[model samples]
Target: MGTVRDILQTKGHAVYSIHPDITVFEALRVLVDKNVGALIVLDNEKVCGIFSERDYARRVIVKGRASKETLIREIMTENPISVTENDSIEDCMVKMTEKHIRHLPVMDHQDRLVGMISIGDVVKYIINEQKYIINNLEGYIKGTR
Candidate 1:
């Protein structure tokens, strides 16, 4: 039953972003440097969209567009779906599954970008939560709780 807040607190709310006007080559370099698959497309400190490797494969490569010549905005997913820090992990999973998305940008109550979470983060958190629950149950059964 952990919330997105718990995950953010554990993982730290650091977001990597790129400008929509940047070339896809530049964005891809940032992605490699950051070791991440997605980057938030920020304009004036606001979430505008998201750019991912999938964007390159689907929008650029498949379409025979040059990465150096193509702007990230041309390939980025515009107005990507986002979640708040208070949103439940279950809610994020449902949205991601339904939308066929891998990453979700997290916002605060003030509508400010806080962090981003991948489906991997959610699954890892859930696995850890289940492990904790199982350990507690075992402790109880062993009269150790």
Candidate 2:
């Protein structure tokens, strides 16, 4: 219904990132500290990959790799699908659905990381929009503005 810019404006652009060279164990600590589901993996201030709980469950735990010894670069999702600030929320929903991803990194016109959006964020925005429309329709029907 709205653009990524709208979402960012509502929820502030605070992106937590980690270096790819960090160990999975260290990354997990950051994840816990940040209370986030995923972290943007940056290499020399450039977005390189993403590390999430899914990566830990499927890549490290399932593969019998030690979290303390394995680096994020080894298992993080590389070249992840991204969305721009101008992209519509519906477009983001379609991309996330098609990719089966829960999170998307947002970039600006200069390709600079601006923020990250989660499936939860999109769902909440849609729900609020629907509620607003329903309220307006009810108000109009009742001649209440």
Using TM-score, give the best candidate's number.
Answer: 2
TM-score of each: 0.97, 0.98
Candidate 2 residue pairs that clash: none
Where is model 2 more than 4 Å wrong at Cα? Answer: none
Residue-level lDDT tens digits of model 1 in 1-99? 878999999999998999999999999999999999999999999889999988989999999999999999888999999999889999999999999
Worst 10 residues of 1 by lDDT: 105-114
- How well does model 1 score by local distance difference test? 0.94
State model 2's lDDT: 0.95
RMSD (Å) per prediction: 0.8, 0.6
Query: Candidate 2 on 13-40: residue-level lDDT in tens?
Result: 9999999998999999999999999999
- Which candidate number maximizes lDDT? 2
After the best TM-score superposition of candidate 2, give how far the Cα of residue 112 lies from its true spot, in angstroms. Answer: 0.8
